[model samples]
Target: MKQPSIARLPRMLKLVLTRRAGFGVRLALVGAVFTLIAGFGEASAQAQTQLALKFKAGDTYQQKVTTRTISGGEVAGEQVKTTLQQEMLISTKVESLTEEGAGNLSQVIEQITLDIGLPKGKSIAYDSNQKEFSDPILASLHKTLGKLAGARFEFTTTTSGEILNFKMPAALTEMAKNQPGGGMMGDSLSEANLRRMFEDAGVSLPKEPVKKGDSWTRKASVKLPIGEVTSHLVFTYDGPENDTLERIVVSGDVEIAPAEKSPLSVKLNSTKLTGLTFFDRNLGRVDSSSMSQVLNVTVAAGGQTNDLTIESQVEMKIVPPKK
Candidate 1:
């Protein structure tokens, strides 16, 4: 099939590619999930078993998230690359627990530190707690991001990290007018990215338990400025490690659906997403996860087409709960 508008696609497609920055920030909200009260006692019971995500009530803990992203793609046939890193501290308090083991939690961004490499040949690094830096730009960004420190946010999640919904106070989204990305923190407040984070959390587990070699499918889709990406992931439970029953293992194959209708005749040449995740069923949280994805797309406009592939990897680690 002949593709659509390629010339107008560069700008919008770039927005879609780089927009993952917001997702990195939103993922910090993937905390305090389901509890495990049901038992896999007998075979009959096991057949009906579902992994529960229950968080302990009245418990407070801290999670440190470090994300490093390396993406390389072609821009107008020239090789371009970006390396970005973000580190944030999240404080979560389980306000209450449900009979089903879900947790209603109050959380906050206690700290944020970042080194962002923008595609426009600009890099900004700052710590939210620092009041000053030798570089005026860094100092301004520091003070700006500092505003989010200690900003109380609310989230409701299942014991398994299924984010029902979340809210960030409007006041917390404001950034100083003179900092990076027009001082808006790269539009981190966008609704689309937030939904993607929610979707990301939802697919961490299958609907039911499985033994090794057993597989299940999770279908996830999200909308972006340029188009929407629909993914079908078949996750296989790799079984527990020989030494520990505490950790459950999982691996998966990822496929992205072609753009059926796009704002600018966008067509995907190919896409791939694959990775592994470790979930501590007892704690009802992910211990760590690593995933790599590659996207090949073509944009047709004015009877000409451009092609590029974007590859990225994301990893997350959570600190054990405080006793």
Candidate 2:
């Protein structure tokens, strides 16, 4: 088998780092996203219900998440489209509980597969489970993200699922430090970045108990590799779906601003985000959640402009442990 040209490796790596780094961030903190959305209602609500996350020592759960992003438009007056898809398996365990009932949680990525499809049907694919790569781009991605498999992140969160403190694995920091743009990558992996991406994007439960038909809105801004995004989400509690699960409806709008001191600038022409979460009060976990986002933006880089329409769909589901 003829190997891909070595000359293309640099451009490929840059493209992955610049355009898809947010997916890496998502892979890192997807567990927290699930946990936060899972604690929507307590089991004991008649007219009003308090929301809290419950965890038991030694309890463990798994989540399977799939995300797909498609962007199409013109780059430098040339038409282009790119599609990225990722599938990940993550495991979360309750290491212990605080005196206040908060959980000391640990999450690890078990498996991951990423595929990026570009115009003309050219594509790059990587799987952490794959051992050998004939293509240089796949080998590079394998070195960067493949190292993430089994990397553990530990954190403490309140009963409401608000993160208090987080610890990034030393290997991850070292991994970023070894990358081409190590400084920027390292900063992007900092606690501040993690919190902004994970916490700000998380579902913030109501401060007080909420009855059926109650609705609240939360606003947050988070920095991503693409840019800084401000989101406005309105959540409506639709009450219980059945005896065990509560359903919440989510809809939102998002706007993007270019990151300071970056060559890439993004102007959002229009954006929308919508989702639904099913929380199982009896299981104390979110059984399933799905979200979709569409962003229409003009990206300026190297004195050229790319008008793109990006659409993303994310679905997460809890995986039951083997008996």
Candidate 3:
């Protein structure tokens, strides 16, 4: 799977991978995950559970997302290796229901933590809950990443989990603007871009109900650190994982979007993506999901070429409201 190069990616994405000023920009990408979960379902009605997403006003849940990514390659005749680990806790509440039965949702980032491993054994760590930072870089990042802990967004979705509208807080955009290499963060966070991301990455539900062993295909265009990748995914309803949960399995292959001309050129050596999702039938919502993705890319830019391999694992879990 060969595709476009990193140069085709948004400036914000480039900064995160190559410059220290990119942490805050990464937050915008993380924030996008909230909407991704809402796009997870579409199944046949032949099963005991309808598979349609449902929400009730006053209902609340907490989602915890953990991601670990590792990238290694060579640039300018020097070996470069980096690893990023991020964890975020998001709280979601159903504020109201529209006449058309859409769920008006309010979401807030309650906490976040990051650990980055740079070349030469150097590392940077930050936790929104921590008060002290021994490293200047970490301290500077705190000024911006700290603010993300309480950032909020609002959106509306239909019963089947289709997004109708979404709003990004102005404060968040401002925070990004203040960071280094952040000039383009605002553009990526704009309503149009966010909507495009949603539409490209989202998984559509089937028009009608489906039974166990049934499967459907979803085409997703995902934005990676390198560039946008279009994937062909087959999602299968694997029936019940347990009495309380239904299972869905996803398998996919990705290809980089081609570019006509650019300073950078990319060759995707190999790639793989897979996921497993558990839906809480009793709650009519997702209980948990996990994904694994790996890509091997050779990028040429500035008269230099680097063979980079990226591996990422993401886990998302929803905690039920306390009685």
Against the unseen true structure, what C-alpha lDDT does each candidate score?
A: 0.61, 0.75, 0.73
lDDT of 3 by residue, 212-298 (tens): 878878765644333556878777888889889889898888899644444557898999899988878788777888888999999
Each candidate's TM vs. the true structure?
Answer: 0.63, 0.77, 0.72
Tens-place lDDT digits, model 1, residues 161-180? 56666776666444322323
lDDT of 1 at 248: 40
TM-score-based ranking, best first? Answer: 2, 3, 1
Off by over 4 Å in 1: 1-50, 117-122, 130-149, 172-188, 198-203, 242-266, 299-306, 320-323
Which ranges in model 2 have alpha carbons more than 4 Å from their true place?
A: 1-46, 76-78, 177-188, 195-203, 217-222, 321-323
Model 1 alpha-carbon miss at residue 81, Å:
1.9
Determine which window of 10 residues in candidate 3 has minimal summed lDDT.
180-189
Report clashes for each candidate as comma-separated counts. Answer: 17, 0, 6
When summed lDDT is taken over every stretch of 10 residues in candidate 2, the lowest stretch is 180-189
TM-score of 1: 0.63
lDDT of 2: 0.75
Candidate 3: segments with Cα more than 4 A from true spot: 1-49, 74-80, 130-136, 139-144, 173-188, 192-204, 220-226, 258-264, 320-323
